[model samples]
Target: MPTSVSDRTGYWDRYAEGRSDHQASREEALKGAFGWTQYPGHGPGDEILGHPATTLELGCGRGDAVAALAARGVAATGLDLSPVHYARARERWRDLPCAQFVHGDAMDYLTQTDKEWDAVYSIWGAVWFTDPGELLPRVHDRLAPGGRLVFAHAPAVPGAYGVQGMYGGGFTGRQVWIYRWAYEPDTWSSILADHGFTDIHARVEPAPEPGLLGTLIVQSRKSRPHRMDDLTSSKV
Candidate 1:
């Protein structure tokens, strides 16, 4: 188990070595899927993004989804903590001018940058690994008005909630631990609402095949300001 950020980075860097086989084809990369179902293109796709002009992806593994958004002419940027993953994403999607990759922690980057995005998302990425109590507020602050936050990850096991620890890809004999959050769909929505988000939607999507694990998809928006006209009309 990695106790510090640097150690965590090393853990993921080592884990990335075994992920070459998981890289998506350029064509398929351009049309991304939100869930990890066996059936191709299953579950909600990028349309859930609602055509954001600018977007950010947290823990973008190989940068496929970022490239997919770039292909759609969205200004897309991916932030990953692993140097190896960052390098791969940069090399694989170099041709896409609108797609950029940054190597850094999500918390550090979000705190340092004043820039905002129309949408921010994670596909089984940071939203799973990072503590939502700490991460969600930063996400809300980094979104432009009416901007959205969307993420998907495997649903928690029965009665499991809050931070859960697990071993990373065990290709090697060394045991490495990583932490992820687990919550039911309704609980996830409540967490987002408590963090000042609006239009919250969180649901569990059944697996493509029976007996397989389902995915938890969550989406919420930074509340847009109330119109003064509407306020006045309501008062009248």
Candidate 2:
């Protein structure tokens, strides 16, 4: 069955049609502003993201990366689950010819949308879904054969995700994947491998500034059709 955007809209407020008025409602999609601080110099994550890259940001909130990418000559689009957030993104990067803002589920959009991209990425956003694993293959199909997927997720280390113990009170963090069952570094790696993504690479990046949580950036590329080892490391 084709992915339906409403399946997600129905769950989160301001995501469905009726939530239009709620855009001005109290409590924004994100409790705080996005874009705390960007990494300095080229790191391993940027190595895989590529230079002058055409990127699809899965949950591009407020367009920080979008604006930055546009400035760097990277063709980028921002897709998000919040119309409120997307509206802000649209207004912020209105003059950017190469940057587009979209209101939709990342997986559903990737699976059903008419466009294909050179890369797919995300920050700490809507990745905590009930079946986020299914998103990998859809990303695989939408990429340009050797395209890559890079994202920063919540740390998988213990004492994180509010778990009380190792397995931690049946915590298992949270159900970001319906079939995959949990959210962890291993879980993400295995999911990517199962979906035919190779050269998997990941690391936890602590924020340079405060008032934000750290992130784990995972970069993977398509294994077939061609090889671009140097191209994979391109970044602005």
Candidate 3:
């Protein structure tokens, strides 16, 4: 269970160049697997985050979603750590003025930028790849008051914390398998509550197949502002 940075960079750089699979397939699976409706229309019991606002997508792989959202009139910025992906995304969406692709660590970008967005989201992105304790607060800081944060992630198969799957016709190569944290729904709720988020909601849906693991989708709003020291110290 090594958490070295190199383990991620190496696998993702290779993944960026080697991914020949349809980007739309990946997006469709997420939308269907998570049962996502159009922006501002969400799963059952979850509040709509609103749409066509300034949005930031952490780990916006290949920038497909960014392009899609931009086409819908949302000002979207897609950030990723891999230059290989950054370049490809930039090239693919160059003509679309609404979509912007940036190359940098999501956390680093959050820490340095003075910009605040109306919505911040991730789809199986930095929320799992990085430490939640460190990532969540920064996300809170970057969102405007009343802004929403939505992210979706899936756990490994029951009794398993990690797995490896082949991709890109096997001709491109394989990516290194990385271990991801599997937290219960309550744990996610508690984390959001502690960080000054309100209207917190977590939904866990059964897997499509009998043996597969379910997906956890969490959405919360920055109801009000809190001091950094206060958010860091309290554990509720």
C-alpha-based local distance difference test score of model 2: 0.62
Where does model 3 exceed 4 Å of error? 1-4, 22-48, 156-179, 209-211, 224-236
**Consecutive 10-residue window with the lowest summed lDDT within model 1:** 31-40
- Highest TM-score among the candidates is held by which one? 1
Q: Who wins the lDDT comparison? A: 1
Could you tell me the C-alpha RMSD of candidate 3 in Å? 7.0
Of candidate 3, the 10-residue stretch with the lowest lDDT total is 32-41
Instruction: Please report the TM-score between candidate 2 and the true structure.
Output: 0.65
Alpha carbon lDDT of each predicted model: 0.85, 0.62, 0.71
Superior candidate under TM-score, 1 versus 3: 1
Clashes in predicted model 3: 0
Summarize candidate 2's per-residue lDDT along 1-236 as a digit string, tens digits.
32233334423333333434325422232222233224433234344576536888877766666666665577888888766678777875687787788898776688787777787777655554425556777888888767887776556555343221222113464222121123466666777888899888765666666655566677788876634766677642
Clashing pairs in 3: none
Of candidates 2 and 1, the better by TM-score: 1
Candidate no. 1 TM-score: 0.91
